[model samples]
Target: MTQIRSRPRSELFAAGVLVTATAILVAQFLTATPTAVVVGDESTRLGTVGWQFGLHDVVVIAVAACAVGASTTALLNGIGSSSATSADTTCSDTSTQESTDSTSSELLQARRQEWETVSERLASNEEQVYQAVLDADGVLPQSEIVNRTELSKATVSRTLDSLEAKNLVERKRRGMGNIVLLT
Candidate 1:
């Protein structure tokens, strides 16, 4: 049996740097400060406000550059080491049809059968949770969602797992709790 592997730690680290850079950029934009320059005669002082790159801007730029560099490195490595495409047919067309066409509609219908199913199985709850996270526009704890939605920890965990399985959610380890994302 073959086992699939999760993403590499390097890629995850690159993604994390990217996220941090984005957040820093946002924070800089939100709280940018203008530098004041005094220009006048000796008797009087006039303060002229000028927009100069501050510490926040520098930090944002540095973080963004690191993110870009790491991402580029990861991409180059992935491309350079990729295996050649295989032409071998692993499954017959009949099996392919049975796997995709025959079950897709049923699964879709089942996903929409009820609210709980929609919340847990379908993308409805995932969408909601994702939107909520985006609306906050910052990293939020998983407990926030659990408390807000009145969902049990297990239910929230399962929903998160389902979301991750669907490539709609990602988790980042941050101290004790994982930071969630709607990828």
Candidate 2:
């Protein structure tokens, strides 16, 4: 005997609904006849061609409506079930979690404001140099900074010196060149 694997209830219900809808539509199609209506004066041989709906069309529309309703219900039910499960799983320590999330967001906002202030005080070249350091994993060799910023080594050195004076950057001697870091 072949063993059958059971699917999720929502999926199974959706599939069954879809199959039923398709079967009904197919049966309606098999029994349907092409229909048309003519309206106007027959004596003048002038008429307007118009379509006429039959029982088959009504059945098809009803099946399509049922299929749509079933799919929508399945989708909403799945979403609701998953959300409910997640809510139950994460219900513990809700207050602490909320506080921690808010605190982290606040810290992020403060850091963004601080950076904005510092950036406003920076010269164009200084900002470029700082960005280069930040892009280099928050610490970069002086040579790498020059390469990344595409600025002259002397300009990078001056910018670094200015940043260091402002306490926005730090430099450590690494071999013949210095490695720069954002403070």
Model 1 agreement with the true structure over 1-183: per-residue lDDT tens digits: 543437757667767766776676667667667766666666454564766777767877777777767776775565322221111134357777556545654654453343234345556666566555544542357878777667787877777876777665566666888777544
- Candidate 2 collision pairs: none
Query: For each candidate, what TM-score against the reference?
Result: 0.35, 0.38
Model 2 worst lDDT window (10 residues): 79-88
- lDDT score, candidate 2, position 96: 64
Output the TM-score of candidate 1. 0.35
Predicted structure with the largest lDDT when compared to the true one: 2
**Residue 176 of model 1, lDDT score:** 83
Task: Please write out the lDDT profile of model 2 over residues 133-172, one tens digit for every residue.
Answer: 6555456899998888899989988888778777787776
